[model samples]
Target: MIETIVLDIGETITRDDRYWASWADWLSVPRHTLSALVGAVVARGLDNAEALRLMRPGIDVAAEYRAREAAGRGEYLDDSDLHEDVRPALAALRAAGARVVIAGNQTVRAGELLRGLGLPADLVVTSGEWGVAKPHPEFFQRVLEVAQAPARATVYVGDHPANDVFPARAAGLRVAHLRRGPWGHLWAGDPEVVAAADWCIDSLMELRTIVGG
Candidate 1:
């Protein structure tokens, strides 16, 4: 029986549209242009780590864009309507005695996002707060310590193959891949890592079947 359900917030629970849309006004460039630039950077042989470093400068621009957008529109990015069944699905897991925790890499702003969306999570673990990010076993270790649950009894659900599944598996937890729209295709292309996961599902709502809701 799965005693705990750990989740990644951004792409796993919330859709990617909100993130991309938030960037549209921030960079003062078209969203497609930014996406193309990201592809270009990756195509130029920059590894994911390097591309992230290169993109760090754009964070300030994004912040300004978000501020302006908020002022003009009076609304922040919309977390795609929570999956219709997510709330009840999560409640079912909890009813089955599973502890739910959210482990993610975010600035201190994560709490606001979680509370803002009214997502149900028993604990929120963040790299910004811990000084370490996913794919690093230490991040999971810290969460394990806090959750006080055995790794074997926990299942981590996330979107990224490397950052989510692999590291959690290394830490001895079952992993569920949240294979949503486009990003799902990107992850599926990675045969080796995708194979590492115990199960993959198209949505959070499907997790109950995987872990026996």
Candidate 2:
């Protein structure tokens, strides 16, 4: 009885191909170079902020983002940026009376942006708001508190194996590993991660069959 479905924002619901491209342009670096930097940062377990600082010393990454927002640039996720399946899937789950939550490793503006975009979500939680990020037990605990549902009755859907699947499972929630994202494709063949998830999906539409919306 999965009464609630928690989802990851980036890669899972929101696609940031254009956003990353803009960031590369701002930094005057090639898109692939920026992608490699992101991969290296993740591989070495470094904070994204720290990675950016290394790339450009004395530049405030947050401030640059704010400036971009102010300048009507890469500030938010447009309809074009959202994965095609997100809206209908979310609507189906809500129609079936399942609570839908967006809890992901995102900045403070993430919730605001999602809300402003009018995404179908009952609650939006971010690492910036929670003061802790994923892979941390406390963060998931807070989400559960907001959900007010038993862990076994909740499912976390995300692309990151370590950040979303494993930690949510450790927190006693069922996990769904969503393929087709950075972390998804990166860790695709890992038997430990794939086997650990209760479900693996290439599209959010698959969730309809698994959760029976």
Candidate 3:
């Protein structure tokens, strides 16, 4: 049975709607336009940030983010940003004696915001805090440390295949490919994704059965 369940932040535990909407407003573009670009980039198997560069060539995304912060607008998250099933599913998992962790490729501020929410997690961390990001074995190693469990006993759950499925599986941890977000649904039926995933889940609640307490 899975003793530790480590989840990705975007799309797995949260909607990611606010994050993209913030960027769209900052770039002075309609939300749908930015959203479409993101889709196109991801379809090409490129990082989502490439969308911003496509919208404004030679754009310095990090600098733009800082500028947004200075202008009294920046990354933000709250209860409204969480998925409808997040709280209940996480709480239930903890009650079932699983070590629940929220780790992902997010900025340090995102980690702070997540921690402030007091989610039912053993640890809430971001790549910015550790200076390592997903698809990197080191990130999964950190996750194992937080989990305090063997890799085989840990299950990494996320919506992205490159960042979540292939890497985690290669790192020796079980992986659950969540078919909820754009990436999730887009690659849901991909032969590679389907084969790589230990389990393919559509809802967080399904995890209750997988962990089986």
Taken over the whole model, the C-alpha lDDT of each candidate is: 0.67, 0.82, 0.93
TM-score for every candidate vs. truth?
A: 0.78, 0.87, 0.98
lDDT of 2: 0.82
lDDT of 3 by residue, 171-202 (tens): 89999999988899999999999999999999
Return whichever of 2 and 3 wins on TM-score: 3
Q: Model 1, which residues run further than 4 Å from truth? A: 38-85
Better of 1 and 2 by lDDT: 2
Shift of residue 101 alpha carbon in model 3, Å: 0.4
**For all the candidates, what are their Cα RMSDs to the real structure?**
3.9, 2.4, 0.9
Question: Cα RMSD (Å) between model 2 and the true structure?
Answer: 2.4
Clashing pairs in 1: 26-65
**Cα deviation of 99, candidate 2, in Å:** 0.8
User: How many steric clashes between backbone atoms does each model show?
Assistant: 1, 0, 0
